[model samples]
Target: MYAVFKRELFSLLNSLMAYITIGVFLLALGLLLWFFPDTSILDYGYAELTGFFSLAPFLFMFLIPAITMRSFAEERREGTYILLATRPLTDWQIILAKYLACLVLVLFSLIPTLIYYYSISELGLPKGNIDTGAVIGSYIGLLLLGSAFTAVGVFASSVTKNQVIAFAISVFICFIVYTGFDAMSQIFALQYLESLLIGLSVNEHYQSISRGVLDTRDLVYFISFVALFLGLTRFVIGGRKW
Candidate 1:
């Protein structure tokens, strides 16, 4: 597992892909947080990252898929997947190694955002007046959200040998998981199922946590969601296919 994990991570970091992706993610957020007129913290005159937290999910829906699009597709294309499998690794180990490696890139992108929190907190009139709980909770929510997206991306990649298709499917699935259900619940005909639909949405739980309140239900939902996708990825690779 460790060997696979290290190789996966090294392949990403050793190339320009990881750096470019992280740079793009951070640059987009930085502009929104400080330069964009509508979303700028300076324009709002506030010490809050509500803008960052709000805009991040949309970006992640794309970022994570791009990262995981090659997880299996490249290996299969290069005929190295069989080679890797012959290395005495369980299917779970392989899945998890790739998942963790993909997730680490997301973490790398997020860590640099802490400077935003610190800068915002200090920008307050009296200094350090930001809502620390909300920031902490939102960061936690983002982490879980990233993990869930990574799992989805991994599963999407496993089902196809085409990287572009994997990215499209992953992005679509992530979208549906994040907001499609909640959007669907808005139909006048589906009002009866609104509660259930909202309950299943990442946006709903994510919003709850973004308010600085930790709920065990939200935590469980993310964990279960991630596990479900990871299990699907394992199942896919475990099948007769490559």
Candidate 2:
């Protein structure tokens, strides 16, 4: 598992596409947080990272899929998965290695944004007046959200041999998981089921955590979401005879 993890992570690091994707993700966020009129923090006159936190998840819906689209898809398409099957690794180990590597790339994209936090903190009216607690909680929520998306992406990749198809599937699933539930909850016909629908939505839990409250229920939901998708990936891979 460790060896597989290293190989996958190193491969991503060596790939120019991975770096370009991360670069574009960061660059977009920077532009939104600083230059965009409607969403810019400076224009809003607030000492918060609301712009970043709000825009990030939408960007992630696309960014994560791009990162994971080639994971198992490339291997399967190139006939390298047959070689991988000859290894001593178990299905779960292989799936997890790819998942962890994608997640590390997500982490790399996020870590650089901390500079925004510091810049915002210093730019506050009274200096360092930003809501530290809420920012921390939001970061926590963001990381968990990224993890769940990575699992979904990996599952999408495992189901197809084409990276483009994998990316599309992952993005569609991510979109539905992120906001479709909330939209469903708002349906007049589903009013009775609103609470249940909202409970299943990723945005609901994410918004709750964004307020700086650490709720175990929200944390559990994110963890379970990741596990469920990863289990699905394992099931798919295991079903393949090769």
Candidate 3:
């Protein structure tokens, strides 16, 4: 697992793909937060980074799938998955290594965004008037959300040999898991069922956590969501295809 993790991380860093992915992520966020008209932070006339947190999950919907689409898809396409499976490593370990690799890249992409927080702090009328606790909570929420997306992407890749198909399927799955539950709740006629459905959505838990409260249930839900996909990836990789 460690060897695979190192190799995957090395491959991501050694190529221009890593730079491009991070660059695009940062650029899109930057433009929306600071440059674009109407939606720009400057126009909003507020020192808080509420806009960033609000838009990040949507941006991640595309960016994360791009990063993980090749996790297993490329290996299978290039016949490296056979070589990888020949090693003594278990299927879950392999899935985890790739998942962590993509997660590291996601974290790296997020690091630069701290500048947004700092900038907002300084721009405030009282200087450093930002909601530090909420900001921290939102960051944690974003990480949890990103981890779930990464796992889903890994599972999508594990089930297919085509990166494009992997990406599309991941985006669709991520979209559904992220928002489908809430949509279902709205459609359901029973209030009790609606409440249950809402609780199942990632956005529901994420928003709850983003309010500077660390609920164990929210954390557990996120972890279980990630684990579910990783487990599915392992099951898929354990098949004859490997």
Best by TM-score: 2
Point out the higher-scoring one by lDDT: 2 or 3: 2
- What's the lDDT for residue 149 in model 1? 94
| Tens digits of lDDT, candidate 2, 1-242 | 99999999999999998989989999998898898898888999889998899999999998999999999999999999999889998999999999999999999989999999999999898999999999999999999899999999999999999999999999999999999999999899999999999999999999999999989999999999999999999889999954
Clashing pairs in model 2, backbone N/Cα/C closer than 3 A = none
lDDT (Cα, 0-100) at 18 in candidate 3 = 68
lDDT to native, each model: 0.92, 0.94, 0.90
lDDT of 3 by residue, 71-167 (tens): 8999999999899998998887888899999999899889999999999999998999889999999999999999999999999998889999999
What is the Cα-based lDDT of residue 106 in candidate 3? 90
Ranking by TM-score: 2, 1, 3
In model 3, what lDDT does residue 132 have? 96
Model 1 misplaced regions, further than 4 Å: none
For each predicted model, how many residue pairs clash, with residues at least 3 apart or on different chains? Answer: 0, 0, 0
Ranking the candidates on lDDT from highest down gives 2, 1, 3
